[model samples]
Target: MFCASLADVFDNSVDLAWRADLWALVRDTPHLDWLVLTKRIGNVSAMLPADWGCGYGNVWLGISVVSQDEADRDIPKLLCLPAAVRWLSLEPLLGSVSLQSATGPFGETLDWAVVGGESGPHARPMKAEWVHDLRAQCGTLAIAFFFKQWGGHENGK
Candidate 1:
């Protein structure tokens, strides 16, 4: 959904797939602040309002990067946007992923990177090395990096 309505609360467990159904409504709404972008593999900006350039309060743009392969494809696309704040939703992190060599025109627009492990009955184990890699990258790039959790029995603190 777009950042013009506060109707949606993000819950990874939700099975709803991303689409253009909520685009028009967000464009018409003025009280929206956050936009949570998620999907298998597609362009989220393509469904947004053409006039929704950027500089809106709390208007965040994020995309799910499940693996290194998806990261290669999604992060670049997300970076190309003109959103006020851009972020990565690395949930259900299945394997090691890094953007060290994926530089491009859009890479410079990145503002935040969130790293987290899968939760629930099928929770997967996350290696500390992977988290460290992201932390190092974010530090080097001056981007915000947040560790959501460690999943399983490991405390993320």
Candidate 2:
């Protein structure tokens, strides 16, 4: 699995490999049967190739929409990617977000979604309503949803 930042590079820090690295790795060796993308919201402005990482059925690209703000910004980018399977990562759900408000690119390409609350010190809050809305949206769109864990401080209790 590749983290979001690894896929999109900005600010001219040229040490890491490009998105094609994923494609190359997968093409060279399809040993990777499952891949999960993390923190995808961090890459709103970066340029990704049209083929985008890997299109193999075994790979899954997921974007983390931490809040409504991230949902608006990053979801579009993730939707536009050429990956075969696209998904959303709503971990650390801090604020309200609506899949109904999502645009065409998002509503169409998304294949799955995961929802969960924040955890650890200074953990943020998540309303059950928010998760319900996300779940409803996923169901409406026929997308799969996964809820990880609520924040350890509040919801976990």
Candidate 3:
């Protein structure tokens, strides 16, 4: 399940009570694996549930990274946290990102990487080479790579 697809679950503006309620719902639904993607990776440590000692077994935590700068800044933060699965959502990819140097605690690498281009009337162009490069990097690292789309189109490349 993609939790809070249109909203940031870790957004500072969201009410704490509402977040608690969402956590409760997550706890109740043990059979479903929740994929929580957030741009505010920094807020996660403080907002997680009390029982999130090593993260929930059913939760796959991910962060949305658009450029190399954001990747450098946020990926490390996400890596520091404990999650059943750590992944990246490179949607609306505006720049090239090389994950060759990104390593997590205990020499861990990202479990998954979803790559896609911007889509919409004013969607920016995504270079095919960029996608190819990322795919190759993920392959070399043995991380699961999912090519979601090429810019200006809905179908995967």
| Tens-digit per-residue lDDT, 1-157, candidate 1 | 3532222323333334443344444555657656665653254544555566663445677777878989987777666666777777777677788776434484455678888887788677877788888888888888789998888738542
RMSD of 3: 1.9
User: What is the Å distance of residue 123 in model 3 from its true position?
Assistant: 0.7
Question: Highest TM-score: which candidate?
Answer: 3
Q: Which ten residues in a row have the lowest lDDT in candidate 3?
A: 148-157
Tell me which residue pairs clash in candidate 2: none
Q: List the RMSD of every prediction in angstroms.
A: 5.4, 3.8, 1.9
TM-score of each: 0.72, 0.73, 0.94
Error of 3 at 48 (Å): 0.4
Cα-based lDDT at residue 96, candidate 3: 86
TM-score, ranked from best to worst? 3, 2, 1
**Regarding lDDT, does 1 or 3 come out ahead?**
3
> By lDDT, highest first, what's the ranking?
3, 1, 2
Off by over 4 Å in 1: 1-32, 54-57, 101-103, 155-157
Question: By how many angstroms RMSD does model 2 differ from the true structure?
Answer: 3.8
